[model samples]
Target: MHDMQKELSTDELMGRFLNQLKDEDQLTEKQKRIMEAAVKLFSEKGFHAASTSEIAKEAGVAEGTIFRHFKTKKDILISLVAPIMLRFASPLLLKDVRKLMGSDLPLDDLLKQLYQNRLQIIEKNWSQIRLIIQEMQFHEELRGAVVENLFGVGRKLAEAFVSSKIQSGEIRNFPPLTVTRALVSMMVGYVFFKFVIFPDEGMNLDDEQEIEIMVDIILNGIRNKE
Candidate 1:
């Protein structure tokens, strides 16, 4: 699907992301405002450059109000990640992914659909994700949270799928975790290459074609050739 096809306003996007949080109902309206403001500011300016006071000003809340909900600026940053992890780890998303894994489509087609599903999610949450990536390098705690909370569960699912594929003679007999790692690395690398290296300006890459090539590369390397 095209990006504009499902484009949501920044308010709408943050609202939806917040809805995914388990503690969403527990959050006050002021807290939601703080989060929305923080996301916009963090995405526009790097995390280090964005301050809690700035977030409070943008949110139209007192600076002390922000601390009433969050312990520190870093706590606010970690809080943003909670909704993201919840979205992917939610039962509905897990069911969709499991369905894809169990489909009888050709490996290439399956991979393409998987790529689209994941890319859609990334596109919807790009603001928080970009900010998280930018700040993760400097914060050991954020790095650990992302790796353990964001990716840990998904990695288990991927490894299990790889194992099943190997057992069915649909893929190479490499270690399931290794195969999962390679596939995940390719997808993550493609995202970084698209956004960081050659973003919208000066580059005109077709996402569909790139996904096809990625699936081809994966199949050529991992498909059972016997």
Candidate 2:
């Protein structure tokens, strides 16, 4: 087949797949309306307490539309993950980190910028984050995809950064992977605890303060004392 023909074929396949997903019995216009309503209802009421009829009414769709799109109402709840991940992953992957850490930016400034960026991302996606945490116990595949797509990229990027810093003699001589995991664990744990575990009294620390504390703790252990 000609290259152009192959490309056209691939495009057609993708279009068909997308259309199928959109037009799924449970995902038609009415179903989408219901799903949107369900998401809001679920967020406010919790998934277990939210009902299909309530979602349908809120969406201005019949209760049957909800069932048509998703065999069970729980499926609508699960579907939110895909859209959330799709919206968030691009920025996380493609944002210009190098520009943020340019030569003019001091280490403290760079760290502060990075932390604030991460914090903003987490805050924006807090709903999806909550959904994943709540459902992971029942859905191993969802948990795996979340780890693979989200944390996996983070770990790779962090490992590369740590390796470069160590090579430049700006950081300590710990194993790159180990240091990356430790740093990520520290940052992720702080975010998870502050936003998810204790949102009522979220960490009120300013970006600079949080970055300073993290940098001080990490640098103290990693910097060559010589």
Candidate 3:
């Protein structure tokens, strides 16, 4: 079976693969400091622009200490990939969807809860998300992982929900994939427009208002029903 097809829990896989070093005392304090510094610097500056010396300075370690932990500056960039996948993508792909699906709340209420949960997650991990988005352009591995683990899982979940709703005649009959894409696109566009494109102006709607407006728009098209 393919690695992707394996049923290993993300936490278990991560612990087995990543924590081994930490458990064996192979990961030193200096390495931990370097990783933290690298995450911050790489998030703020693109990988091409970030420097080992700058990372070392931020970590309060000698420049050579970086090489002791990482073979090259590029290794530091690569290191960000696993953590980004484990910390950010894994929760959305593996955990949040399960909780959302199991909830007894109504669809609209559930969506609001899920939206808030996602928003909080994004706000807390904004730097890491920014780093992944920035680095994805240059790294094929990062791009593939985002496509396979993040967007792919999300698309699948959305399709499942849309299909169920359509089967029950709760929603208009449309291609499940198309509906999923449209819904996801709308939410992503709203987030990008608010945070990335017009951040200086601030969010136009508060959380509750935003949820209400978004839910209304999604459930009912822009066309007047009358």
Candidate 4:
């Protein structure tokens, strides 16, 4: 929304997104405090091991105050997940994606934009995302809920986007799903390698510049030349 993709760090974007949503939701100061506390503790300690009292202590609120906003600890987890879904996993944001697929934009340009947008989202919510991923391994119901509510429609939209690119001869001919996976891997893999595997803080390249290189490699490797 701010067009500060290359300028802002992931933490800044996350703080901005959090503040924006808090204002929209009209969450009380105490509620914000509790939510922040829950994020910290849940990420540090497993949710099963983190108690309401510990979260309350971290937030500097009475334990009962958390119940004022959330019915249970699980509800707290859902609240943390909502911002991610609204930003990246929602179908409303698919309009821009659909336009990109249908437009005459260069594949490199479209993919560079897509990669930056995704990295911004992932970086902004890495903590909550990591927590959710960890918990989903043990919680079938939580995984099912995420799949049904977010991934189901999101996957279809992604497939449709990939199909559009294929029909236009922009990329190689392959199964839409395979194309989706390849594109996604390039995007996600860069983040994993750059931030997690290598942790290069001294890199001078911004997200757009780095992702453009990745897009070039992908296109050069995959383009169908008749």
Name the best candidate (by lDDT).
1
* Pairs that clash in candidate 1: none
Candidate 3 off by > 4 Å:
1-29, 88-93, 203-205, 224-226
Candidate 1 residue-wise lDDT, 1-226, digit = tens: 1111343443443444355455768788998899989999988987778888899999999998987777667567767876776788666667889999999988789989999889878878988888878877876656665676557879888988899999999998999988998899998988888877778741577778888989888888656679
**What is the RMSD, in Å, between candidate 4 and the native fold over all Cα?**
9.9
RMSD of each: 9.6, 8.6, 6.6, 9.9
Q: Quote model 3's TM-score.
A: 0.78
Clashing pairs in 3: none
lDDT of 4: 0.72
lDDT of 3 by residue, 1-226 (tens): 1112333343443443344323215557887789779889987887867888999999999988887777677666555556556654565445876678566667777777767777776767666677878887976655665777767766777788779878978778999988887776766776777678888654555866786778778787678879
Better of 2 and 4 by lDDT: 4
Highest TM-score scorer: 4
Candidate 4 matches the true fold with a TM-score of 0.79
lDDT of each: 0.78, 0.64, 0.70, 0.72
Q: How accurate locally is residue 148 in candidate 3, as Cα lDDT from 0 to 100?
A: 73
Deviation of model 4 at 92, angstroms: 2.1
Ranking by lDDT: 1, 4, 3, 2
Q: What C-alpha lDDT does candidate 2 achieve relative to the native structure?
A: 0.64
The better-scoring model by TM-score among 1 and 3 is 3
